[model samples]
Target: MTVLILSVFVLVYLGMAIGRFPGLQIDRTGIALLGAVILALAGAIPGEALATAIDYPTLFILLGLMILSAQFELAGFYGWCAVRLAQAALSPVALLALVVAVGGGLSAVLANDVVVFAMTPLLCAGLVARGLDARPYLIALAGAANAGSAATIIGNPQNILIGQLGHLDFWPFLAACAVPAVLAMVCVFATVAFIWRGRLELADASPLPLSPPDLDLWHLKKALLATLVLLVFFATPLPQEEGVLAVAAAMLISRRFASRRMLGLVDWHLLVLFAALFVVTAALARTGLPAAMVATLANSGWAPDRLSVLAPLSLVASNTIGNVPAVLLLMQVWPSPPEGALYALAVLSTLSGNLLLLGSLANLIVVERAAASGVTLGFWEHAKCGVPMTLSSIALAIGWLWAMGHVGW
Candidate 1:
């Protein structure tokens, strides 16, 4: 049973890292689900224990946020923001800052992937229309989204998982991560705008003029109201999952977007992936091998309870297998991690994705979207900003967290 659980866990995570089997059509989500099924069939995890293994709060919080984002996407609010940012009466450098500002800021509140998806084309089109190169702005878009999403527990999926699993509150988590997030965004803008200074000026006007998506003002208003109410609830003693679920329910009650369509937009695959990971991880934990291994490693100064250990470890792991998987792996092994260590792990894992184009989903979305739209933002072009962005941002995050006396090596 132990070997079977370990084997299933290993194979599933391998699929997660590679994103697919060599010849199989399965994705990370499918691989995770498969692992859980294998465990169940083998009796590694029993009936009642199955439900206990999954983190329902995290899954529901993620679901509600995705639905809220979908409503805004359908209403064209993100498009409206991007177009408005694009037309700002600012110079290239200033405009890039504004672009980063908006991308990063909104990502703290909404799903960065959705924000990037809506903003990319409009941003690229608007900038390209003015004869400025879109590559740098695109890079900044990716980096800023990663950084900004670090500011809050709800910003991205990994942080959401960390927050839910850690039982982190909204305001306190924000206070812990906001400074590093802000500094990272600044670093993102500086690296891109400075490196691509000349190119940010006129290249050639876009051969194709593009218009932003039309805004459904009514739905937009509805989402904004619901969001504000959610925020107020977040400030209160209310649970994030419950508040977000209520908000999502309110949005679904709308006549403009059908419930099925809106729910369809939610990343159910990701929620399933989370649930599957939890089950497989719980099965792994029952083997006692993890706790023993973690105990042995703690003496070697690699325990996740140690901030110095978790930070760099998280940075490397996050980039290696992606942030979500890294967090899940840590969850399986790390027992009763300190709040400081968890916060550090969450923020560092998120911000470190700025290191590579494939590092984060937000970055990937921006790159793929740019490619399909005829702009060629290649590796080097992205790395020019990404490498520096990662280094500077991580440094800033560590420094800020240290200064604020959160935790430091």
Candidate 2:
């Protein structure tokens, strides 16, 4: 049973790192689901224990946030923001700064992946229409999304999980990460601007038609109201999952958008991914090998409980298996981690994901959308900006956390 569980876990994480099997169409979500299924069939995790293995609170919170973001999407709010950014009569460098600013700011509150998904194509079309190179802007958009999402727990999937599991306060989490996130956005603008210098204009490009969704002022008003209510809940003693779920339910009572459409827009793929990882990790924990290994590692001065160790580990783990999965895996192995360590983990894992194109789902979404828009944003092209931006931002995060006495060496 132990061997079987370990084998399944290894195969699933390998799929995560490589993104897929050589000839299989299965993605990280599928890999995780399959691992859980394998464990259940082999009796590594009994059907009765399945319920205990999954964390439903985390899923509910994710679903609620997705619904909130979907409201913005259906109202054409995200597209409108992108169009405005593109249509602004700013210079090349100024335009880059605006892209980073808008992308980061929106991502700090909404789901970063969804924000990038809605903005990428429209932003690309607008830039190309203006005869400007869209490559740098797209890269900055992805990096900004990653960096900005670090500011709040609800900003990204990994941070959401960390916040829920760690029982982190919303305001304090924001206070801890806001500065690093802001500096990271600056890094995004600087790195992209420096690398794409003198290459901002495209002479032969013609104006491409923008296709943003028609603005629904009424629905946008409702979204804003719901967002304010959510903030109120966060400030109070009310449970986050319950409050957000309530807000999502109220949004569903709308006459403009159908419940089916709103729910469909939610990333069920990501939700399933989180559930599947929870099951897989739980099954492995039943083997007791993880606790033993952690004990040995802790005694050897190599535990992920300190700033120095966690920073590098987060960088490698986040860039490899991805930040969400890396955080889930670490939570399983690291028993009863300190609150400060949790903050460090959340900030470091998120910032480190900006190191490469394959680092975050937001980055991949931007790249894929750009490719569809005839803008080639290759791996090395992104790395040129991502590498430096990530390194600098990560350094800033570490310094801030350490100086503030949030974490120890």
Candidate 3:
């Protein structure tokens, strides 16, 4: 049973590496679901074990945040903000900075994925109208969204999982991550500005078409009010995950928008993937392989010494299997890392998402949307910004962590 579970785990992550299973129509979500079922069927995990393995607190927090984000989206707040940014009479360089700042800032509060989905089209349309190259702005928006989300516990799916699993408090985690996140955003702006400068200048500055009028003001106001209330709760010393989530659920119920429509905005596929991944990874945790692996490393005189290897390893694993699963796996081996190492690990893993187009879902969404707009950001184009942004952010993170004595080495 242990061998079977281990095999399933390896195969599932291998699928993640390849971005999908070969010769199958399955995506990451589908592969995860299949892996979970295989573990159950193979007797590695019984139905009860599987049920217990799912992290309901994490799931509830994620669902609540998604609902809140959906309310904002349905009210067209993101679109309105994007349009306003577009109409600002700044040069392309200034405009890029604005987009990155605003995009990144919002991502800290809302899910990065939803922010990208809502903002990408408006940005693309705005660039096309102004004859400015849209590619760099689109890339900046995606990269900055990922960078910004690293700052807060509720910012991204991976962070949410880490916070729930590690029981990290919101404010302390924010303090640890804020520096790295800020540095990452600056890196994003500089990298994109350099790459797109010439193209932006050469393009004609024709007047753009008017943005579609803002959505219902009343609904937007209500969503804004709920969001502010949630922020106040988060800012206070109150236990954030459940408290803020209850606020979200309340907002969802009070909506003039139909319940079906609100629920439809939820990323059911993503939620399913999280639940399945919980079972699959939990099964692997029970297999004892992680403990054996750790012992082997310690015996080989290769025990991780915090600043020297673990930090870089965290970035690599995050890029490979994603931050959530990588952090989950790492926690089993290094259960009680030094004071701030867990938080540092979280920051490093997340900021590394900018290293490649496939490193984060936010990047993929930007590329996909760009392609749909007849402007594709190929792998190399993305790496131009991703590499520098990732390197700089990691460097800054290491410096901060070391200064704070978070790393044992």
Candidate 4:
């Protein structure tokens, strides 16, 4: 049973590393689900244990946010924002800054994936209508969303999981991460703008047509109100997870939107991924491999006591298996890292997503949307901005963390 669990864990991570089995139909989520089943079937973990390993608070939060985002999408809120921003007639630099600012700001409040999903089409359409090169704006959108999400506990899945698991406070975590997130956004704007400066000119001066359609005012109002209430709750002394769940329930009960539609928008696959990882990691933890590995590193004078080593490792691990899973694995070994190491880990892991096209889901969405719209944003093109953006943002985070003495090492 132990060998079976370990093998399943290895195969799952390997699939994550390679993204998929060559010529086979499998993805990270599928691989993770399979691993969980294998572990259960092999008697490494019982079904009840597997169920217990799943973090319902985090899952509920993600589900609720997705529903809220879907409601906004149905109301055409994202389209409206994009059109308004694009119509400002700003210069290329100003437009780039606006994209990053809006994308980042929204992402800090809403789910990063939802923000990217809604923003991508609008951005692509707006740029195409303006006859402007969409690559820089698209890349900035992806990078900004990922970076912006680092600011708050509920901003992204990884942050949500980290906050829930680490018991990090909402406002304090934001305070710790806000500066770096802002700096990262600025860096994202500058990097993309600088690289694509010459390509920002509009080839056509035609104004894009906006046809008014029937708006779902009630649904939009309900989602907006629930979101605002959730924010207020987060800002208060209430239990974070419970408050979020309450807001979600209120939204779910409202007749303004169908519960079925809202529920369907939830990313069950992502939740499954987290649950499976929890079980697999739990099995690995049972083997005491993490302690042994940490011991080996400690003996070699490579302990996580140094921010220099810790920060870079966090970045690399994040880009490798994504920020959420990376945080889960790292937290197991270094449960209570330095005072602000958790926040630093959240920020760096998110910012590191810009290092490569495949570094994060947000980047992949942008690339896929671009491809569908006859605009190709290959990995190399993305890396041109991703590499620099990632490096600069990470450097800024490390400097801030060190200067503030947030991390003793």
Candidate maximizing lDDT? 2
On TM-score, the leading prediction is 2
How well does candidate 3 score on lDDT at residue 368?
88
Clashing pairs in 3: none
Worst 10 residues of 1 by lDDT: 202-211
Which of the two candidates, 2 or 4, achieves a greater TM-score against the reference? 2
TM-score of each: 0.95, 0.97, 0.94, 0.95
Candidate 1: stretches off by over 4 Å: 205-208
Record all residue pairs in model 4 with backbone atoms less than 3 Å apart, i.e. clashing.
307-409
Give a tens-digit lDDT track for model 3, residues 119-236: 8888787777778778888889998999899999888988887787777877888888888898889989998888666776637656768575568787777777877887776667
Per-residue alpha-carbon lDDT of model 4 for 1-409, expressed as tens digits? 6677678888888888778889989898888888877777777876667677677777777777777787777777777777666666788789889999999999999998888877677677777877788888899999999999989988898888888778777788888999999999999999998888788887887886643235678877877898898888778878766777787787677655688877776777878888778877877776777888888987998877567777788778777877777877777666466657787778878888889987788888888877876778888888999999999998998888778877755
* Model 1: pairs clashing at backbone N, Cα or C within 3 Å: none
Q: Which ten residues in a row have the lowest lDDT in candidate 2?
A: 201-210
Quote the lDDT for 385 in model 4: 92
Candidate 1 accuracy as TM-score: 0.95
For all candidates in order, the CA lDDT equals: 0.85, 0.90, 0.81, 0.81
Ranking 2 against 3 by TM-score, winner: 2
Positional deviation of residue 171's Cα in model 1 after best superposition, in angstroms = 1.3
Candidate 4 — worst ten consecutive residues by lDDT sum? 208-217
